[model samples]
Target: MEIDQPYGTPERDVMCVMVCGKLVDIDLHGRRYDGLVGLIRAGGTDMSEAMVAASAAWEYARYDSDQTMPGFRAAACQQGRGL
Candidate 1:
């Protein structure tokens, strides 16, 4: 995981986590869901490892991690060009 301080939006310069090349929004303390609806873009690397880490928040997390809130799994991740 890497912090992208310049993850820009019309509102402001949102910070996001570069997880296996996928962009997951994060907060000052850690994982964030401030304005997130879902992943607005896709990734090149296998994003499962990064997905698990990104969805670590207790309320939104589960055994499958990706099944709970982030809402896209391994197969879906690679489908077409976006998720």
Candidate 2:
């Protein structure tokens, strides 16, 4: 990802997408926006269909990428650390 203002905050703009060293898709989210709240709002959903749509989009995007199935106890090891 290209850093437009890396020193100010670690907020990232999806500059590009790559799978196994090849760019496959493009993102249209614009730059120059406050990111923390926007990031949360990106995943923020209330309706069931909204959640399904988001999950489907993620699965389609990462369909060709490496996949991992997390174990049941994986959550207790790291709570919100990766978040």
Candidate 3:
């Protein structure tokens, strides 16, 4: 798994999570948090759940000293990419 920090503005930060050459999640944080929350409230929990989990996992892995997101790495490896 890889956490990609693409170009973003002060109002929005784009975080992309890729596993086995496939994009599994994309998280937009910072000023867009409220909008995302509102979307979740108006939509449903299913999408929110996945995004939240991905965001949390990204945070944990990004901050950890080892800099490794084990879950995503394992999944990516199993899917045939060494990442």
Worst 10 residues of 3 by lDDT: 7-16
Q: Which candidate ranks first by TM-score, i.e. highest?
A: 3
Candidate lDDT scores, in order, read 0.34, 0.26, 0.33
Tens digits of per-residue lDDT for model 3, 1-83: 12343322311221223223342343443353233412222122233333333442232343334334465545554665321
Candidate 2, position 73, lDDT: 21
What is residue 56's positional error in candidate 2, in angstroms?
A: 22
TM-score of each: 0.21, 0.19, 0.21
Q: How many residue pairs clash in each candidate?
A: 0, 0, 0
Which prediction has the highest lDDT against the true structure? 1
lDDT of 2 by residue, 1-83 (tens): 22453321221312111123343333334454444211212223222122223221122233223232132124423453211
lDDT of 1 by residue, 57-76 (tens): 21234433345334443333
- Show where candidate 1 strays beyond 4 Å: 1-34, 40-42, 45-51, 54-65, 68-83
